[model samples]
Target chain A: MEQSKKLSAGILRNDRLMADGRTIRYYDTSGQNRSAKDARPVEKQPAIGELRLDPLVNEWIAMASHRQGRIFLPPKELCPLCPTTGELLTEIPESDFEVVVFDNRSPSLRPPTGDWALPDQVGPDTDLGSAAGKCEVICFTAEHGNAFKDLTPARVRVLLEAWIDRTAELSQESFIEHIAPFENRGEEIGVTLTHPHGQIYAYSYIPPRVEKMLAAANKYKTSTGKVLFDEVVAREIRDEERIIARNDRWIAFVPYAARYPFEIHVAPLNPVADLTGLTDQDRDAFAPIALEVMKRLDGVFGIDMAYIAAWHQAPVRVGRDVLRLHWQITSVRRAPGKLKYLAGSESAMGAFIMDMRPEQSAAQLREVVL
Target chain B: MEQSKKLSAGILRNDRLMADGRTIRYYDTSGQNRSAKDARPVEKQPAIGELRLDPLVNEWIAMASHRQGRIFLPPKELCPLCPTTGELLTEIPESDFEVVVFDNRSPSLRPPTGDWALPDQVGPDTDLGSAAGKCEVICFTAEHGNAFKDLTPARVRVLLEAWIDRTAELSQESFIEHIAPFENRGEEIGVTLTHPHGQIYAYSYIPPRVEKMLAAANKYKTSTGKVLFDEVVAREIRDEERIIARNDRWIAFVPYAARYPFEIHVAPLNPVADLTGLTDQDRDAFAPIALEVMKRLDGVFGIDMAYIAAWHQAPVRVGRDVLRLHWQITSVRRAPGKLKYLAGSESAMGAFIMDMRPEQSAAQLREVVL
Candidate 1:
């Protein structure tokens, strides 16, 4: 293997291929050997999921039936995210690693096969397409018991670098439209794995949410000659009440129109279209703020908040300049034991009825000191 | 008080004003005495929620902060939907009633209280408007420990008549745009009260999902000179593989692109724009099919399947002819204990990655001999 590149913040990156033709990568604080051979036999990759255009919404819905048998809250001893040690072989062949990312065994999307299906056969006004792209799981640590907030600053910096490198590499794929790096933390959010990990989904098409944001951004630009996300950041900064933490490069604040009970947005002070555009300084500055926001979230209700921390980045093939990168952390936990579920109105109608006001939630979050 | 009106299918309807000036209606299989005074003291009405335009999606999000402390899984004794006795008082004042519909105490939307806020002051590109409409709860049965599937055919017909009556009555209000009568069943779907109840939300603006459907329907009409929903039902009938049940008046089938693990769509064979448009014969025919579908859903896992049964009806004033009324029942339960949670892809990006195929789910439902 070629010499490992010492990336920003003393992080070393080494890439490898798995037995099933999936890519795996390791990021280490210390430049160490991560090259390990897969002991398990090569297995046939499952068929790529089928994407059908929903006639009602004119949107694509992925049908990943193979994922039905995927792991669900597996015992810690059989956790696939845990590093392999002795007889306990896992997804990672490495005995130990600071950070590791591997292709998901049962992915919603995967590398396309040669075969393709026609649209007419799927259904009326429905077009069949391959769920082409990548879905990777990033394990923060092999220890598996700690939360992302407990990670050291150096570790978080390494994770951020890993995210940037992956985004840059994944954007090269001609068909990939958006790369989403998100973490579904806590069982309340349906997180099956207790390990402190996240997922990266490289979608073949611009997702619905991102598409809507792009349209809004373009509209805002046409109307006001200013970026929509930039205005949002400026407004939050001016308000100051919702601001959780801020530095020269990054600022974290609860959005004015939060859909969730506990929702916060962390964005760079300067506009960055995607993670690939983040400078070393930007990455360094974001780690502490992100960590602090997560800590504050946990402090609220004195428990680990079940949240979906999603990185909203500009689509790779379009809307790069107008759309700005931001991390949205939305928790459904309304109170100590209550969860705000997306029921009839929210689930079926896509009209969110927020239980708490954003200003009140921000005040509560601000009161929780790290 | 006015004499009870004998509605279609021998259902009796009696309307009265609550202590707080909210409307309450009772539906009975027989024209019985439904007059019972609310024993509780008059309570102050909650302030109307604010409607904020979510710039990203161009959608209105209802900020109903007053709903934070709403009843959540109340005990059987404190069940608000239960019939009030001499010692117990509930939302339904009548000591004995077949089925009742009353205004929600903690509503997402309500009649405007005349104190309206300005738009520009809320936020950039955000509009502030009163959540001016109605939110009502419909008790399916007087019993607190039974599912909708367990309701008798007579009771189901009465419920259908109530839905039809409410749709017609609520549509007369100038501010009501769409009336959504849906049931969030089981604790899994966040049904706060276990009193076998459903809810009707009369929204001032068209919901996001309904708007998309309307746009698609209009586009389809312009392109093919055909209504989109009618074509969907026709296509499903022709395919036959996804059909779960069919009768002369109504047919239930799984959609081509179902976003949930167990999703079934029930549509009238003859086009009906909304519940108000349903004839007496249509209502009678629909009750049995709807009940059977629910029974099969429960039998799929031999347990009460938590599902969201939403009525997708035409808007009050627009697209009444082109848009068809349909019932969409979506269950998150993937297996006996597993649920398909909206995690990273779904919750964050509005991209659904379903674990089950429509055909397979339909076949399973069809196999259940109910």
Candidate 2:
């Protein structure tokens, strides 16, 4: 395995080859020497999936049938994300590690096959392209019980630096168009693993939501001759109603048209196109607010609310100047005992009917003590 | 309440006013006389919600905060859609009826307030308009516990007729741009009621998904110089692997790129633009196929699969000639106990990673003995 040079954040990066010829990396904050061998027997890698174009919606659907048999919620002793112990061998070969990232065993996308053909017809005749990209899992800690919110400020900063490095690294791939680092927490959100981990998907094409945002940003820029991100931050600061928290470096607010019961968007005051563009000072300032927001989310429902925390960044090769980087956290839990499911209207029509007003949600979130 | 004239079908339409100044209608197959009076006391109607434009996605989100307290999983005795019995005064006033259509007590959209303003800016200043549209509930039968698949062919035909009548009627309203008739079935899909009922949402603007489809259709026509609907149906007929069932008037098949675990699309073989364009023969021919498809969905897991059955129709004022009418039935049940929840990728990025191949799903559905 080829190892990259260490980053400037005092985190050592050790890369190793997994039993299935997949790349795995370990980020150790203590600068400890790491083992680069896997004791598990080698196995054949799963075949890469195919991407089929949905003509009606002008989107691509990655068909990964092999993922149906992926590991579900397993017992603690059988957890795949945990570090290898004396009796329990896991995905991480090391006995202990601060943080680790590896290619997913059952990935929706894979390395390019060098045959990229777009479907030419509107109907089903085996018109598909290779699902060529990368999907990697980033473990936040070796101990399995805590969440990203429970980590210390230093640990959160390390995680942030790891994300920034991965984003920059993945963006360099010619075929990858979008890089998304997101966390799906809690079993209610259909998280197959109970470990505190996030995933980074390098998509072959710009995702549908990002594409729409880019178009909107371009339109806003053309109409007003001002950046959309700056305008949004200015408006939120002026209103002060939906704003959840703010500092000199960043602002967090419940968006005016929130689609979920509880939704928050965190944006840096200094405009950056993506994570790589963030300065070290900007990264250091983000840790506390991220933790505070996540803690507030858990406090809202008196439980670890099932939510998706996604980073929306500019596309790798396009819309760099207009699209800005932000973090969106959305929870589907409408009440303590109820969840907001995407049913008829939301799932089919792509129209959202929010049950909670953004202002009320922001007020409730603000009332929570961290 | 004003009653519209009767149609050629002998389904007598009795329009009545609810206690809250809302409209309710009854469609009787036997021409039974309705009481046409509400026994319950009048109450204040919930205020109409607002529609906020989501500038990021160029979509409108209806904010109906009052709907948070709407009815959830109630006991069989308190089933709101059931007929009024001796001590149980339900939403339906009469003791017996074949079909009933009524205004939702807690609707996401309602009649406009005549104050319609598009947001001038792109940020959080309450740039909203009245949620101006109608939302109606269409009860398939008066029976307390029965799925739509259990309904007789005649009952399904009556329901189809009711949908056609409602679509044509709602299309005439200048405020309503799209009419969607959809059903969210099974408790796992967050269905509040167990009764056999569907919903008709007359949206003030074209829905996000429908708008995208129309754009794709227009683009396909411009490039190929052929109708996209005709091309799709013809291609599906040629490729027999994904076809589940077909008749002279309709064809049902799993689409080339399916997002859900078990998704089937039923398209009119004659290429009708909307439900209103369907002929009597087309309406009569749709019943058996609809029932068979629903039964196969249930048979897949040997349980009542949680699903959303949605009607994709052309916009009322535009895209009538380009967009074709289709029925999309998507089940979230990936396995017996597991469901395919839209988490990080699907929910945040609008990118779908399908667990099952469409061909395999079609094969499984085709093997079911319905």
Candidate 3:
């Protein structure tokens, strides 16, 4: 194991190797040493997933057949994400920790083994490429039943710090092109674990959505000599119809062309290519609104809404100037006991049909007394 | 009301007007009159849905706030798609019918009122355009509990005839650039009605997935001087591993890079641009294989698997030579009671992570006794 290093925002980083040859990193604010030994039995490493290029849509599909046997909605007593106790050993070796991140045991992407060059054109019989990237699991807290909404602002800031540190560290890999840090909350969205946690997926190729945004930003820049992200925030502020929450450094608003019923975007007032570029003050301002927006979402329907909170960042080596960082939170819950399923049109045709207008959703969000 | 016209395959087409001034077309194999009046209360016409271009992805989002109140999971006694009885006035105004097509009461797209032109570039504050096209509901059978798998091959042929006639007719509308015929089955995928029915959407612009397929096909055609769809079917034939069901004119195979746990694509053996281009013999051979594939899917788990059956055809005006007709059926059911949800990686990043390999799923499908 390497020596513990000090990261920005007074975060102490300790990196350790698990028994099965996987890396685990602990980010603590108190700067405690995390050298506890993993007491579980070592097993053979699973084979890496394969990435096949879909010729019909020109996108990559990751086949992780080994993941079919991963842990599912386990009981609270058997939760693997909780800190290790005297009676039971879990994924984490330490008795307690502020924040922790480790390699996924059955990852959709694995660390690259060799050169990761892909063919220019793919056919039906083309050889599949290795999913030569990384997938990491980030535990927000050690508490089993707590949610992200129950975290304090200071703890939220610590989570943000961990995200920044991991994003910067993952970018050093030669095969990585994009990094996505996201949280899938609520069992309605197929969250296998009851504990509050997030995941970071490092991709060898830029994802399709990010690629589309990059292309759109570049086209807008060439045509108008203006950044499209800036224009979007400015327009949201001027319109004021979809703005739900705002602070000095950040704004959270429902986009005019939202595809989901309850969709919100938290963007910095100034241009920031990625989370690593956020200043200390900017990070401090983001924590409060982030919690407020989440509370408002739960308040609207008075239930735990199923949502996917995704961070859209620029590519590691390209599109830094045009693609800006934004946190997009979208919920599948349209009404009480009803979910918005991606059926034939949305799933197969890539056409979105919203059940309500964005302004109505924004008004409902704003009316919530959080 | 227009006179009952004789269509291909000895089918009679009857066009009628409902109380709300909507058009309803009934396709019958028995050549019976369908002039029964819609006895429901006439209300003011709802405002058409608006199309907002998402600048981030450059795709149109249909905002149909009126659809929120559409009928959902009605009891068997009150199914809207069933033939009207003495006490119940349903959408279908007849006592019995072979197959029927009618305008959706709460449509996402309406008939173009005037000239429909979209701006070349959309900004945040761009005025939204009307959803200028058509949305129609197709009732496969008048029997309330009979599913598509239970239908006779002759009845399935009649349904295919309706699809072909509708596709050819919708192409005449100047505003329509693409036509999609799809079925969303089971409550898991948000099928509001319990009857065995489908929908046809006449799009004013090419959808995102179709657009991507078109670009890929065009590129492949230019480089290889061959059609991409033909190459895909031919490759599936040569491999023979993923081929689940086949006939003289059609083949149903799991693609090499399937996005869903159970995905099957049924394509014609010859070059057929759209459903209208299919010969009578081709249509006859397709009905049996389609039923076989659906039955095998249900037989895999001894349950009615929830699925989306989407028909991908050539665009109304463009990509006719490169894009061929096919049916893509994908299920979210991973196991008996488990579903594969579109969470972070899929819903947000447009990345798909399959739980199992295509060959494994194909073998399972092939082993099922239908």
Candidate 4:
């Protein structure tokens, strides 16, 4: 096996050299790496807002219109991601549609190509990936809106199957290392494209964080001579301070040092890499826990709670199979919106100074029968 | 000087030890140092989050309310941090208030009586260091509403003066290492008791991060044989990609791996232990740049953006100040709230993946003539 030399170049050796053959390219402290990038100063829509990155934490923040604020404050009566191109209405039908993957036609930007295909490289200026891989929408209903919280377990299982199907199909591209499918919901969380949908990004590289985790898991395996997550999941099951809800096959717990309040992680009883390993029963087992967690968030907060549902699977590359696949759900109510601060410690210093204890949170979460 | 005996305890020394007797402590496999000791909850506010230790990367995460949502959206008129105590109508005041430091009327959680106050050999939980320390409010204003962004330069100068007074007075504690003064604005960024006031936390030990930075700085200094900050700050100035604003004495820039959107770091030309070294002339020069950045953020988002204004000063106890005292202003606007997701990269994995480039952001910020 060729050792990957990513962080720097040159140093490559034998079996012991993991990420060694590929140079670990150190980004020059200078601004050169960012030089080639180009951004379109698109006309800002009063309906939508401008987005920028918070330089400290490196997260993208959107500044939407006051109208958008009104939409967020009030519940969603509209589903924007609906409007299909070519005689398509902005309003989606109230009934179901066939599982279709098409280019987002009603758009200022979509990879302009003759054929319905993904770009080889995908970005702002260059159509790399250069295809859109598979751009599509999974409308559980054509009507206004609802989160996975409103979906029946059977419906959710269908959604999971859709996800599994998409992942498998997208993975055929040797260029794609990881495929991410995520969903955003409610006005509070800011869902402009409200047609209750999730997206799949067939990434070119194993994102930096996943890359690091692969290294850590490998290290853990080498040292303990066993799986690291196995130890963690067992230890968590034993302690139970952070565990919110768990069934026979799946467990959801608040991670230690959770950056956001009400951050939940749902994992399998064992590690899984590819969706090919998932049985028809796996979807049936996992969908309920996710829904329960969502219900608990809404029940506890009183109003619609904003959350990001992320499915972190192993990269399609060589070693992701041994890694664990899980979903980390985060809601931002850090004390009624006035005090969920990512301050100097967490932002610049990387220290998470949290005011709440996991046990107390779990007690409250577990108490909620929803 | 007595070494921090954390290594000898149940905690394993993470990373190799330094000959100076300094070693990074891993609480557990996750860089968390948990044992029978820390396992006993501190009987504090119902733990909303857990701090996970990452031994490999040597970082801590707060995982309490990991699933709660909508952190920064504030009440329309009712500011919750409004005073319930006395004549203070506005929790976040508009006018200036004199610097007042006194013993908190609230009962101490640690309960100090006699010998507890008199420091000596004591158990970890019984240690009086945690008790004697005081927390105060620097009422930035006397009137009810407004934030650090709203302050005039002269008013900001006044607040800066208060910071100097507190830092000098508190460093004499013999136990106090760092004096952390931070302000949280907008409901979403976690401003509990929304007063236009900043908090002062004088810690007994330098929280793990300050300690880590000192080592990184020391190592950077050793490798290059130059002041790491001086070299880095100069490079940032030259690159100008991340530079937010420049003043005569200080230069403000968004950090490369910024943990938040529109995060600004203000670094000084001259490095010092505390703010006393800063002459009024210099602070006056820097205030507008600070104000300018805040104004630009509001302009960029076109709403009152939520942010954390935190100061990272040298630990008061350990006299060796690591000349990296700066303010990190972070707002959570990762793509207009619609796509403000802290995905696996930033959350589970420590790596930061920013969608927006800093140079483009700097260009946008520079265009804002605040």
Per-candidate Cα lDDT values, in order, are 0.85, 0.87, 0.90, 0.51
* Per-residue accuracy of model 1 over B247-366 as CA lDDT, tens digit each: 889999999999999999999888989988887678889878998999999998888899999999999989887899999999999999889899999989988899899999999999
Residue-by-residue lDDT tens digits, candidate 1, A158-209 = 8888888889889987767899999999887788889999999999888888
Write the residue-wise lDDT of candidate 3 on A1-370 in tens digits. Answer: 6458888778888998888878889988887889898889998888788998788878899999999888899998899999999987888999998889999999999887767766766765577988878999999999998988888898898899989988998999998989999999998889999899999999888998888888889988898888888888898899999999999999999999999999999999987999999998998888899999999999998988889999999999999998999999999889998888889889889999999899999999999998
lDDT of 4: 0.51
Candidate with top TM-score is: 3
Task: Residues A59-94, candidate 4: write the lDDT tens digits.
Answer: 232232222122333234344434333443232221
lDDT per residue, candidate 3, B148-169, as tens digits? 9999998898899999999998
Better of 1 and 3 by lDDT: 3
- Candidate with more favorable, higher DockQ: 2 or 4: 2
- Order of models, best lDDT first: 3, 2, 1, 4
In CAPRI terms, model 4 is classed as: incorrect
**How would the docking of model 1 be graded?**
medium
TM-score per prediction, in order, is 0.96, 0.98, 0.99, 0.63
What's the residue-level lDDT of A239 in candidate 3? 92
Q: Which ten-residue region of model 1 chain A has the weakest summed lDDT?
A: A115-124
Clashing pairs in 2: none
